[model samples]
Target: MKKKLLVFLLIGVLVFSMAGCGNNAEKPKSDIKVAMVTDEGGVHDQSFNQSAWEGLKKAEKDFGIKVSYVESQQDADFAPNFETLLDAGNDLIWGIGYKLSDALLDAATNNPDQLYAIVDFSYGDKTPDNVVGVVFKAEQSSFLVGYIAGKMTETNKVGFVGGTAGDVIWGFDYGFQAGVQYAAKELGKEIEILNQYAESFSDVSKGKAIATQMYQQGADIIFHASGDTGNGVIEAAKEQDKWAIGVDRDQNYLAPDNVLTSAMKRVDVGVYNVVKDLVEDNFPGGQTVVYGLEEGAVGIAPTSDKHVPKEILEEVKELEKKIIDGEIEVPYNEETFKEFMKTL
Candidate 1:
């Protein structure tokens, strides 16, 4: 009877120990799925789409959210890809370019329960309650880099190659031109800007052709906002031993010797913030969030070489402060650009 009692007590202790261990074990994390649909530039464009994807990847790491993406090969693919993501049970979906604005709106309308965010788009008063618009004051940063190109160029001729003539792309174009003009005036020099649009974000050959032509026309540095197409411009700059400025990402590594700097748009931050908000139940829908130099959403990448002088960088920083302080207004459209040109 004594031995039986001892065995029974041991069994009870074992059961209690197992119960305590079970109570102390970590609970399984709830699944929060987030997905993105890239624009025509796709994820590997090393530009806007790539930046958005980087933000999604970061969210997955930090928040333990399941993340996936669908690449849009053309304009027609946008809506379909959004559907694919929705069908796959994504709790939050993002469209990663201004081109996806309409598609995102349509999707948001049809799927009112799902949360959506779009980068580089402004819906103004038309924003849906289920959608969030993320835009950047790219012109503000483009101006700074344009100043860099203006001050660094020995030929007094700079060039801009753009992917499209849309409003968002035009922001980069107008801002850069304005910055160049501002720098030229400050330096007491006359500079001519050669600008053109390739009309497509993925046409590498066309971008290269445009850059080569500009360089041949005595342009010492070419700034391209042509997405993957800008990759071609970089190659042309390398081949001709000229300088190339990248857009949206720090492309110095693309051709470290030839790339002077890059006009950066913090798409990653925008995407990450929207996703974080959704995760935290504080999503700011039915609104447009504009990030600018003041918000550290746009700027120029660090110069990879000694081509840009320290004084020029310092001057650019001063200009950045002025813009952020509202002492200087960067042009973001054709009308504003024309007005800005008058000041120059």
Candidate 2:
């Protein structure tokens, strides 16, 4: 019996030694690192760029990846930042905002072997095999807010302030206008909408001045798509004790009483998804990712009950459903959108 026990103990020791050796023989996973380039609005602007940064930070936490970022001081820095990130041996480079599209395209083309992703814009003709484009259907949420404003307006007057004049900014403008018109027609209400563009995203003073003018013109609810510049619009609304809608992330908390609802663009979700894909070895390159109502990437922030009426809340819920169910179509271009506005 003693001899048998000794033989069993020897066999167990040999098995443990072989298993430990095999474990050490396996190769470690490659380290994945990502970097982001912010547009004109610096990081922590509490808007679009901030949201994207938050997403990247989350990816860093989840994947154990080294993350770095550079805020572009001027437009010229976009290409240089991309070059610096690639040259630094980053596994992926992310460009935030539509303003960087041209630069991103140039850099991505020059560095064909480097993987790149961008938000808010895409390559005009064809995307390179290593480049991924991310865009949001901001109209989904903008439409809901338009419906709410049209219903809640006492003077039949609403306003939309855009950050720029182009397809990118107009996408929000046209969508909001269409939503207002749709609700006005169906609800048998009369609401007038005033639309204007600030021509830039960083000038908060200009946004404030424009918003103040709209209020003087009898606009009770004004929606500003400008970045930090929109904060000035909110300030104007607060000073006047009127309502202002926020864009990209919830600004309702920024001014609880004055902010009605936010048109959420889910920029963070876009950044997180791309990083996750790269980490999981499912990189979605050479593809344009469109996040819309169905994906929960673009929609309206929940209305803080402190400001909005219950009826308005119910109306927004119904509109969200229709948008998701495909019963309502929001117009997205100037000409077609202008015709739709006539119905309001």
Candidate 3:
């Protein structure tokens, strides 16, 4: 009887342990796995790549989905990194930059069933049925900052450092120049702008050298649309006790006193919305999503340094409203920019 009782108790403990194990086992994996492929800038670029990654992280938390990313060190890495993510069972893959257009297009064409998205590029009539292109009105926000830079310049000379000479970056350049020209007309002051392209987003030394030369040439404020290279621009500004404008993200936190403001491009919002749509089964494929000031996806960062006058800030706010209301048309390219300059 004693042996039987002991055996029965052991069996009961064993069954309970088995039940607990079954209950604690991880739930079946989430069906929706999303992944991102970063451009040569890498994920911590503190600009474009960082913003996109933040969106992926948000989707992972909000939807209980699986997410991953691969950082491409150079142009050659794009296709392989994309394929790796797909092979790893990602339901959606995002390429974060205009440079990835060809690779992404090829991949989407070959794998017609896989969903893909690319930032800063649009195929227009050639858009694939399974791909969505995300673009931004970067010029609109750059114009705002350019106006501020014009008003704040002590020397009446400002500078712009662009990462690359492309339609996307050109939008920033033209909008900035137009804004400066408008501000010059308003203030009845002669403003000069010195513009240069670093030709590389990752070359910090090149950015710093270009900015330093501009500053030496009497430019009191400089704006950079370079990626990680902008870091060097900010450093040069701080060292020289000058002002700098940032791009893509609000970078005033980097040097609150030195950074006048940032031209904001809400890349994170774009990425988040794309993933949310995918998860919710309403993915808007075969279309280009253009986010602009009206959509609150682009704007100028708040002036946190107290260098910009209250009246000037108010004026900028009014201009923002005008742009959003379609009362003010910001130029997006060189030709329109020149025409806009003529009007000013």
How many pairs of residues in model 1 come into backbone collision?
0
Q: Count steric clashes of candidate 2.
A: 0
Q: What is the C-alpha RMSD, rounded to one decimal, of candidate 3?
A: 6.9
Candidate 3 residue lDDT tens string, 119-166 = 999999799999999999999999999999988888999999999889
- Select the stronger candidate by lDDT from 1 and 2: 1
Residue range 287-331, candidate 2, lDDT tens digits: 899898889898778654566788878777787787778777677
Order of candidates by TM-score, top first? 1, 3, 2
Residue 265, candidate 3: how far off, in angstroms? 0.2
- TM-scores for all predictions: 0.90, 0.88, 0.90
- After TM-score superposition, the amount by which residue 219's alpha carbon in candidate 3 deviates from its true location, in angstroms, is 0.6
Candidate models: Cα lDDT each: 0.90, 0.85, 0.90
